[model samples]
Target: MTDTNRTCFMKGQGAQPRRDRSQLPPRKMATLIIVLTMLFFLAAAHNAAAQPQKPQPERPLVFVPGILGSRLVDDNGTVIWGDRNSYLNFPKLEIAPSGPVTALHSDGRLVESINVLGPFWTIHQYDTLLHYLHSLGYIDNETLFVFAYDWRLSNFETAKQLQTFVDDPKRGRLQNGQFDLLSHSMGGIVSKLWMVKEGGAARVHKAIYMGTPFQGSMNAFETLSDGWGDFTNFIAGGLPTVRRVALSFPALYELLPTYDKCCRLGSPEKYTPLDVLDVATWRQRDWLPSEYRANGPRGAAFERGLSEARRVGELMRQPIPGVAQVMIAGDYFDTGLYLYVPTNRQSWRDWNFRRSKGDGTVPVWSAANNFSSIEGTEPSFQQHATIFADKYLQNKLERELLNTAPPPVKHDVLGEIDTPKHEKRRLDLARADLSPRIAEPGANATVTVAFEFETGVTRGDVQPTAQLLQRGAADAPITLVETTTDADLAVRRLTFAGSLVAPAVEDTYRIDINVAGQGDHAVFLTVLSAGRRQP
Candidate 1:
């Protein structure tokens, strides 16, 4: 049977049983009807408030996260991958195989694994995207959903799954049998496969791609051949995880540089059609033992993986006729070129890494589809990792997804000049009025905290709140206060104040300040106090 036929058969086998509404009694049925009606209206009102005042109904949004973005956990709730601690301690921990690309559930409700962490810090994947959409009044599940799949699988399989998700009768199908897609990096490849091979053009209204390597990334080839490098390994915690990721995942092989379309290093020369196995053998001579040269299991796997990748790449080059495509490519950073110099045995470097412009991972030419569809490309200075977090990109995505009017076709380099600097929000204690470092019981003190935003960022409508709590009792709030924004200077400041009262017993008290909205800032304060004043 054909792949599409096999996919349909598999979907049929896994189809979930629908709820039997007819089983309810007459009185229960009447109550259910009333409850459902009330819920429907309440949800409608909530959506109305969240979305812009446009005549069109809110279209459903399906977000596809990039590589290492989805949380992988076992049946017992133990994380398998995508968690910093788990990944770092991968050898020590009982690493469980990711069962399948499936949805996570908690109490019978869908649980989203939208973001993952690097070795030392959190690497936000789609959290910023989702938060921005939510701030614009997009309701979760009702109007927004995430497609979290195993990044190890082929794009073809993932594309098939996306097809099933969009066509599912019970919980799929947004408004008017169409939806908007926002894809980042590798997710864009998956989206392209779905649109081209799985007939997603009929269902997708607008497809927005951010920092997508449509042609493929030379970095993938480098990482698989040489090593993940110090920076990437440090970010991923160690080389083991990177090695496992590079060798195990078929998807990464799909991201190999499309040589035929890419330019050679140090010049604007394009390469001839190159075989995947030949390139792999040339690059990984030392890594791949001499015995397993061309006909070994490793070589066979590479051949198989490359074969599938080539098939997907061929299909991806074809444009979806009905769906509107928006390609957002990043520029400014030095990108890897198609050229690679083999310095010595098992040693190579990208030829034009110091001069080529890209998003630091994907070269600009590759990100722009080698200028094949340059008329639709939107270039920005933001790096591949930060493109989705960019407010400009967010605004553009909103306009394309929500507005009724068709987005204008403009081939221009945007946000390249006077590029906005991205920074993390910070909260700090500005002032405090405590006569004595150690206050007696019932003694009162006032504390003030300040939240500062980066130059380009503006504070959202949701304000910050300050709460005072005792150690070991974070659930209870001793005192609480809200913040007021001061946007007088280039750097906006949000100040929060609260009064703290000492308890009857002698102990240390903690003050916590939290801001709402995406990239929220938080601050904590510890204060020591004696027993209440002697009566």
Candidate 2:
């Protein structure tokens, strides 16, 4: 039995020996499996290394708004400067009683005011800009900020404060410690002062300025000399209150026309420069009575203020250097160029002031600084107050801010469409009864236009007529007839009736008004295809 069992075991027949796990497969197959497993892991690691990561965010943006664009509040949190209700109340609600207008400060940090009191009192007016930035993925406080200060103070003082704000460690550092700045109107002056005087040039990567009065405005001089006139009475409740408040600020005086920069042809022989503070000049021009020439304590205050303003103007004449700047100016609206000498004694209502191309507040020459190093100067028909809301201007600003390369020097001057005749006429189309609401091709529409003339202009003499035409097509015009006239000589209404056949393509159409002796007036209307809906 032992011999048989030993023979069987030796021949691997009686009891099979346990097979080793490592030897289950052939040697070449085992090597191949190990190689394949290693290759799989290696490929996964390589793929992970090749994948792209998310991009880093853009640099921070800071907005500095123009004058009267920041709310001033008292210690009790009652608004003093930005509250339109308070302004309308005027002397009735004295700001002095509530304590001088102060900023809301906490823990040595300034909390910017976000209040915007309607269209008239547009203080802290950055809601649209902030919203646009946010939509582009910029977080509030982290990437976007508004630097607001007492606009009544000197721009130099405000510039120093801006330096402090940018250098603060509590606020997150911008890309490479550099930021983009967007400023408007008077804020441009403050930004310029900061860059030129406060070493802000090194910290800023790019700057965009809109409607900056670098060369000063003649309108400013006229304002200080004659007050806001009808504008203050109609829009601001009273002239005395606004005049008193405006006079207290030295910044307003700094905005007075710099005689050397603002002189135009007066008599073709001599260039007459503006002298706002001179009482004799006002009396000679018949702007005010001889007795009104710098009289009483008010006049003494004005003299002192003018002295400070002169110093500011001198300092501002120094050009800002070593910074990438983009200047945007507005034009094509009626802006005061020079005051016309009165033929006879006439009140402020009849005071004829010649106007030229401007933004209705700042002349084109002043805003563009006579075309000095302007990266882009856009001539908009919009007024000064409404220029900020223009779509073209907003797009231009956004593009400039986002671009890494320096902006191309572009001076786009959209020429005037229809020159407004005598500004006193205040001839504007009221949108109250505009017909069809939406204009489409092959559709009939009726539009009612109410035009107001000056007190002295007669309806018979005006002979107002209107015509409808496609924007680019001059020859194709639909004649509009006079529908009605107001009993008052100063008021008249016209109507345009008929079907305006839409062109084969979608385009904009316009309403052109011809006041025989006055001038031509035009307002734009959009015309869409018959089946298409407005986007």
Using lDDT as the measure, the top candidate is 1
lDDT of 2 by residue, 1-535 (tens): 6976776776676556556687646888899999999999999999987986322235688878787677656567666555544344333322221233333321221223322123222222455555666655567678877787877666777888888878777676653478888887888888878887787888787888777787667676466446644433434446555555565565776676663525332433454454655544444554432223466435554565566666666666676665677777765455776654344543333444566666777777677766344335665434565466555565566566653333443432233112235333334322113355446656666555444322344333334456666435664555554444455443543333333444444444555554443333444444555444422
Q: How accurate is candidate 2 locally (lDDT)?
A: 0.56
Per-candidate TM-scores read 0.58, 0.59
For model 1, what is the alpha-carbon lDDT of residue 123?
A: 37
Candidate 1: tens digits of C-alpha lDDT, residues 1-535:
9977877787799976555676987899899999999999999999989986652325888888776566655567766564545334333322113323233321221123222233122334455666687876677667777787766677888899877766666554553578889888988999989888887878888888887888788777666545544433554555645554455567877887764734232234433333543446444534443323476445555566677877766776776787888888766444676553333322333333323556767777677775544556776545676576554566577567764643543422242111123334432112223333345567776666443333333544224455655545654443445455445234554455667665554544444444332221222222323222211
Q: Between which residue pairs do clashes occur in model 2?
A: 69-124
How many pairs of residues collide in each model? 3, 1
Runs of candidate 2 with Cα error greater than 4 angstroms are 1-58, 84-86, 89-125, 174-176, 221-237, 259-272, 277-295, 298-300, 340-351, 371-376, 403-535
